[model samples]
Target: MKTKIGLFLVVALFLNSCSTSKTVGKVPLYEVLVVNNDGGANIKFYEILTEANEIMLLLGDETLKKKVKKEDAQKSSFIILNAGPTKETFNRATVQKVLEKEDAIEVYIKDMQKNVEADLANENVFYPYSIIKINSKKQIVIK
Candidate 1:
């Protein structure tokens, strides 16, 4: 009886320790660039970069375009959403929610026209995209 009880206790502890941890919340939007226009956002592609070489290849700017602070170890996990030129305003692309699932990281976004009033007098084509920093480095699946 004593051995059986001890065995059960050990098994229970092991199971508890193996529980999965997830990050679920409204993640902040990492806005680095600002483009002035009244337009819409049509996501062309989403890229996940954790290495310096890859970051430079895609997010490189000044030397001549998209860039991420690649030196910091803490900001290793980055998901960038790139949008194509839009005729209407995709004014505000927001990251609504982030779910860290077992297989992948799920991201919910709002890429529609913003309700807030904007000066349309100087209306021009706008390009918009959203980016977020995730706790995990899992593959992102946008929803």
Candidate 2:
């Protein structure tokens, strides 16, 4: 009876070991590329382009196509949002998370808070922009 029990335990352990596995995650869930903020006086401040046509229209060129390889015009959420023209060149921004909710994908960003006071007319301005690549194309909203 002892030998039989040991055999059963061995079988059980083998089965368990075969079934155990570590969850493998997809390498890149999303990609972010900081473009620029030179469009300082852009009246249309922040622009998030999720489709190829819109990106082409806004950029008026093949810049987006050149950036992302194997481009999926329908499912590409490319962000060209401007964030600059500030006095501080050392300021920074970070991409926190990108999530898909219903028909839209939200892009979360952490950036240094700007001063409440308006910039003086003569203050040096800088343009800071970034491009976000959503894994699946959909509406890209910045928050």
TM-score of 1: 0.47
Alpha-carbon lDDT of model 1: 0.56
lDDT leader: 2
Q: Write the per-residue lDDT of candidate 1 for residues 17-85, one digit (tens) a residue.
A: 999988698634333333334323443556676665665554454521433454432444666665555
Clash totals in order:
10, 6
- Candidate 2 lDDT for residue 24: 97
- TM-score against native, each model: 0.47, 0.57
**In model 1, which regions exceed 4 Å deviation?**
1-43, 56-75, 87-90, 113-123
What lDDT does each candidate get?
0.56, 0.62
Q: Which pairs in model 1 have colliding backbones?
A: 39-88, 39-89, 39-90, 40-88, 40-89, 40-90, 41-90, 59-66, 59-67, 61-65
Residues 32-112 of candidate 2 have per-residue lDDT tens digits of 754554444322245666657675563444555565554445656566555555655643555789888898888888877
**Model 2, residue 141: displacement in angstroms?**
3.1
Candidate 2, residue 82: the lDDT equals 54
